[model samples]
Target: MISKIIVSVLYFAVVFYLGYKGWQNTRKASDYMLAGRRMNPFVMAMSYGATFISTSAIIGFGGAAGLFGFSLLWLTVANVFIGIFLAMTVFGRRTRRMGLCLNCHTFPELLGRRFDSSFIQGFSGLIIFLFIPVYAAAVLIGISRMLEVSLNIPYDWALIGMTAILAVYVVTGGLKAVMYTDAFQGGIMMVMMIILLYYTYSALGGVTSAHQTLTDMAAMMPEKLQKGGMLGWTQGAKFGTPLWLVIYTTIIYGVGIGVLAQPQLAVRFMTVKSDKQLNRAVLFGGIFIPLMTGVAFIVGALSNAVFTARGGKIAIAQAGGNIDKIIPTYIEQVMPDWFAGLFLLGMFAAAMSTLSSQYHVGGTSLGRDVIERGLFKRVGTSAKASQIGVTVTILATLVWAWVLPESIIARATAFFFGLCAASFLPVYLLGLYWKGITKVAAKVSMVGGFAGSMLWLLFVHEKEAAGLGICQWLTGQPTLVSAATKGSWVWLLQWVDPNVVALPISFLLAVGVSLMTKPMRQEHLEQCWANF
Candidate 1:
């Protein structure tokens, strides 16, 4: 017990120390919000990679790997190629250049300035305000779960403690604190993950034995999992899942394409000082992200073998047969107390890193994007106003922390990622590359994506509706439509992937509106589209 307390206190102290150092560096609102537009590539890379992966990747997705076999590795690949590489090479340079030119601090400000519309800023802020809480809650739940498992603390106390610490640092120090602390925490995570992976494999008697044990365990699969297209890795077809579903839903579609539009991630580009920094960060981030995410997934799958050999279960006992707890359960059983404490700290670091970024991004959206543009613009751009914005943001996030729901961490994370992808990626991408994209087009696209995605997820998507508790209560049956749920046209459209539906809706709306409205002037177009 003393050891746990010591480890926990030491971890908190290190984070707070880093936060203090970052706080010392802040002299202006820009420094507090965007690291004064000057950050080293290595720090930027570690911050981005750490913020991107998080407890969601370690615990939530690790739990997924244990449940879903090796299918989750595809997400790591996406995180590297798409999230890191494509984002840095494709969007990073233009965003940094344009952001600098426009003197923009937040993503909504960039979009608003580029398109010449305060509406875009307001709309972008609205989306962030609505969706980010779900993501924040997801991270909070993940941290609480690990604390509950590792320190044997009550879940609510763990949640409150973690949330308070994160909020205090973020509220006091802003993005500088976030990035510096992320660098420190990211290091802990990388080292801890590597050690845990090595120890877990060693405990299982090495690679060959682990694979053989896993194969034998597959042979003893439960009747229920065998029905859900989860026939382990070897016997794929017996579970009624086609190759298309396996590749699309599990690999290509579910996580592979999902990383591109993560709002928490996209804002990182705006925080850097230059294209050169983004370029350098990309290489470091590419290598680091894959290593962290890949190791976590590999460890998760290998845990199945160890758990089965030890007569332990590999399925998720929570979330109604969902497979998200495999890693947490495995960690509790396999790791010794000391290493377990380190692993738990690493997990906490993961959760806190991501949660801090989410809250920062969300607060910026609410304070800078929404409130500043609409009602608070009259107050002027004084440091006092920025401070007030910061205070409001911290209070708003605290309310969310208090009211977060249970067992929705994974879904909530996925939902926000999807929302960002659907609403912002199309317009944001086009605004950078396509000179023909007029302000009208950008506004329409933003509205279309935001409204369309929300409507689809709320009313149409059976999975989302069911997860949100809207389906069962309305229909009296869990499915999309039923005899009891007669006016359910929205649920019927839920079959369409939001990316497929909303991306095109946003693109077409942007283009169609842009073409119909006045074309962008040559000078304006050249100014915005000059870099590429």
Candidate 2:
């Protein structure tokens, strides 16, 4: 506890100094929002990776790996090849160039300016302001659980305490403070994850020996898992299996591709001075993302060996059936006290880096993009409005943390990621590349995508469907239709990710609506395509 207190205190002091520096350097709104677009590539890369990967990836998905086994590593592959590489290279270059062309500061602002419509900006911001809290709550729950388990802090106190500290820096220092602290936190995360990966392998002997042990234990997998579609602990699920659908579509592909359209991630592109920074940032991101995600997945799967050897149980069993708690419990029980302290602080760093970015983006969406830009004619008073936005965002995170369930980290992360991909990806992609993307098409795509994602989650997806209890309340059944029913034979909606269904619906609408509607104005097209 003494070491824990010391590490936390020292870590916070550095964050405070960075926050103060950001405050000092920020004189104009541009500096507050984008650091005057002069940030170095290293900082941008660290910020992007830090913000993109968080407690949700570590605690939440790590927990998922414990239950689902090593197959979850597919997400790491997607996150690297697509989330990091393609996002930074293909998406980042265009976003930076076009954002500069339009002088757009926010993701929604870029979309709105591209189509010459304030409604698009406001609506998009409204979607973010509304849905992002669930994701933030997932991050909050990650560290809050660690504090609960490790330090014996009350959950409410931990939630409030963490949010208050984050709000201090986020509200005062803005994006500059957020980015600097993110870089620092990202360093902590990388170092700690490396130590964790080493400790995990060493706990089980060595890499080859440890994996062989897990492979030998395949027949010992829980009956529930095999029934749910898992073939073993060391391999992917059988094709046409329920667990296979969940892992491949919902967890892997959903989060992998969904990272492309993240509003918060998109805004980072405009913060850099040029595409050169983005190129360099990719090398950093390529290493950082893989380390963060790859280690989490590996450690989560390997934890089964440690748990069985020590407690005569599986990782999920030791965690009391909640996948979210597996990583925290594993660290506390299996790791040395000193490494545990460092890992705790690392988890804190992960949580803070993510939460600060979420709050900053959510607040900006509400204040600058929605209220100030959408409701008011003037933009000068948005600074104060942004504070209000941050406050609201903090309150929302607390509310969600209170209401959410255990083992929800990965699902919550995917839920938001999928929704954003469905709602924003098509419009964002079309707006960037297609001259035919009209305002009407953009608006319809967003609406269609949002509607499809929500409807499917509520009525179709099993865990969420069962959890909501809406179908039960309305029709006296678990889902809208029983799986045993003939009508449910076309159960793709039940098995596939909502994003898979929703994104295509959204893109087709975008392309079809765009085709039918009048093309963008010549002046709008010329402005958007100026430097492409």
Candidate 3:
């Protein structure tokens, strides 16, 4: 116990010290928000990767690997090539040039400037305010689950403690503090994950034994998993999920293409000073994000062998049979006390790093995008306005965190990612690459995607269907012919991943609307296009 407390104290001191130094360097709002717009490529890369892949990936996705088997490995591949490679090559340089050209600081501001529409800025800010908290709450739940497993703390206190600490550094120092702390935390995560991989492998005897054990276990999966085509990547049914319409949705579009639309990630492009810096950052991010995520998935799958050999038990009972607790449970049981402390701190680092970025992005969207342009122009440049925006954002997120409902961490995280991809990606990509995109089209696309995603979640998503008693009510009514004849309503709603539906809807709406409205002037087109 003394050892654990000592380790915790040392970790807190290091983080607070770095945050203090970052606060000292912050003099202007630009520095607080964008690191003075002169961050080095390596720091920016590590910070970006750290913010993107947090406890949600390590614990939440790791739990997914245990339950779904190796099929989910495709996401890591997509994340590397699409999220890193395509983002840098296709969007990075253009975004940096456009942002600098218009003096845009936040993503909503960037879109508002690109198309010459204050409506786009205000609408985009509203979407961020509504959806980002869901994602932030998911991150909070993931870290809280780990703490509950490792330290035997109640989940509510764990959530409160983690949220409070993250809020402090983010509110005090903003982006400069977030980047510097992310770099420091990123180092700890890399080292600790490597050690975890080593220890996890050794615990099961060796790699060969681990693979054999997993292969044996795969043969004994329950009918529910097998029927859903989740047995393995190669052997499952090709189409139509059993209960939920197991469409090819998991691999083709779910998480694979969704990374392109992440708002927290989009803002990173504005922080670097030049396109060359972005190029350099991509190379580093390409290697780091995949390595960390890939290793976590590998370790999570391998843990099944250890659990099976002990008693065929994969999860602890007190945590409500959640697969998300598997990685944390394994760490506490297998690793030494001191190393477990390091592991716990790494988990906290992952949570805090991602949380800080979310808060910073959401705050900027409120401050610069909505308030400054919408209703508070007279007080826009005042320090009080910025502080008020930040304070309100923090309070709103806190309310969402406090009232969060119980759900699997990965599904919740993916839901918000889907929301962002659906609502923002279409407009953002078009604004950067296509000069023909008009202000009216941009607004239509954003609103359409937002409505489509919400409808899907409310009426179609399994969790929502189950929670709202919709499925039960439908099943009870004999006159409801579809529910009686067809087993359940889960299939009707399970055709395509939300991103697949949302992206195309947003794109087509934008195109259709732009054609109907008058096009932008040739002079305006040439000015925006020349930068690329």
Candidate with better lDDT, 1 vs 3? 3
Q: Candidate 1 — which residues are off by over 4 angstroms? A: 233-247, 250-255, 317-324, 374-376, 379-406, 469-496, 529-532
TM per candidate: 0.90, 0.97, 0.91
Across residues 466-518, which tens digit of lDDT does each residue of candidate 1 receive?
66676677766554443333334443344445565777788789878877888
lDDT of each: 0.72, 0.88, 0.73
Query: Can you write out model 2's per-residue Cα lDDT over 1-532, one digit (the tens) per residue?
Result: 8999898899999999998988888777677777779887898899999999899999999999887888888899898888889888888999999999999878988988988888888988999999899999999999998998888899899998998999898998888999999999999999999999998898889999999998888887899888877877787588767788899989998999899999889999999988888999878887998799999999999899988878658998899988888999998999999988899989988999999999988988888899877645456766777778888998999899989987889999999999999999999988887888898999899899999999888887877888889877877876664556442445544777899889999999999998899887898789888978
Give residue 213's error in model 3 in angstroms.
Answer: 1.4
Poorest lDDT segment (10 consecutive residues) of candidate 3: 477-486
Residue 420 lDDT (model 3): 81
Per-prediction backbone clash count = 2, 0, 2
Ranking by lDDT: 2, 3, 1
> Highest lDDT, which number?
2
